[model samples]
Target: MIRGEVYEYTIGNLRARIVVVSANPYNPQRATFAVILGADVPTPKSPSLVPLAAGDPTRGTIDMTRLRPLTRENLGARIGRLTRTTLVAVDDALRTYLGL
Candidate 1:
């Protein structure tokens, strides 16, 4: 999957929504694991959380603080993609959170 794509995955007994944050090329071709940020609702007030677009069906904040590497096999169906603006915001949050 490409960056900015959202997908569902089961972690233990909890099913969670995740957004792919890994860059392309490596993420699609080379990498065995892709980096993702869990999406959670009731958007909390945090500098690291990037809110999804208003029109998004899966409304939640991308928790930048908790970056998890998920294997391709673990990832489920494609939920939805982030809007251009939201993706940019996520990139900015990631930069700030990662100190990049």
Candidate 2:
């Protein structure tokens, strides 16, 4: 697995579009964590969505406010991928989230 790829993974009983925010994949024992998206429409740079595009729908919006820690047990099926541009924006958001 690679960073920036969006997937429809199931965490417990709920399923949502989550973006892989961690680095390095080969190891599948545990997932560092991910940003989860929901039916709630995200707004630009809000506590929820960062830079919401008027007509853009690529990956889960950069939700700096939330994340989920998953493992091989909770990791579910793959839904789709995110565009490179959006992924880059997400990377920026992540850096901001961590203040790194």
Candidate 3:
């Protein structure tokens, strides 16, 4: 079974979760690998241009044309990184367990 902690972080009004797991493969008594999941957030940067009309009435314009699109892309990248990291950790754990 996978065991880990879920860490939450807020970017602007968005909340994101990051799951971290320490896997024990070698001895079943020691943590052999670390797995990180979630932790998805848009990179800390602004887009090139702002949209003409965007944002909530109470929050004002959010620059939908640029920031919104870029935010999605950034989030995707973060998720991709999380997935890769988790896979690598799992692979390592399996390899260690099998003496590969």
| Candidate 1 Cα outliers beyond 4 Å, as residue runs | 29-43
Give the candidates in order of lDDT, highest first: 1, 2, 3
Q: Tens-digit lDDT track for model 2 on 1-100?
A: 5665566666668776676667656336545556655546655545335543434344235576676665655566665556666657767777777777
* TM-scores, one per candidate: 0.81, 0.68, 0.20
Best by TM-score: 1
lDDT of 3 at 19: 29
TM-score of 1: 0.81
- Candidate 3, 8-96: lDDT as tens digits: 33457765433223442422333222222221423333332111112211111111122111122212122212234433444454455
How big is the positional error of residue 34 in model 3, measured in Å on the Cα after superposition?
16
For model 1, what is the alpha-carbon lDDT of residue 11?
80
Kindly list the per-residue Cα lDDT of model 1 for residues 1-100, writing each as its tens digit: 7778888877877677887777877676543222344353355677788777776547767788878776676778888787888878878887888799
lDDT scores in order: 0.71, 0.59, 0.29
Least accurate stretch of 10 residues (summed lDDT) in model 3? 50-59
lDDT of 1 at 98: 78
lDDT of 2 at 89: 72
| Alpha-carbon RMSD of each model | 3.1, 3.4, 16.3
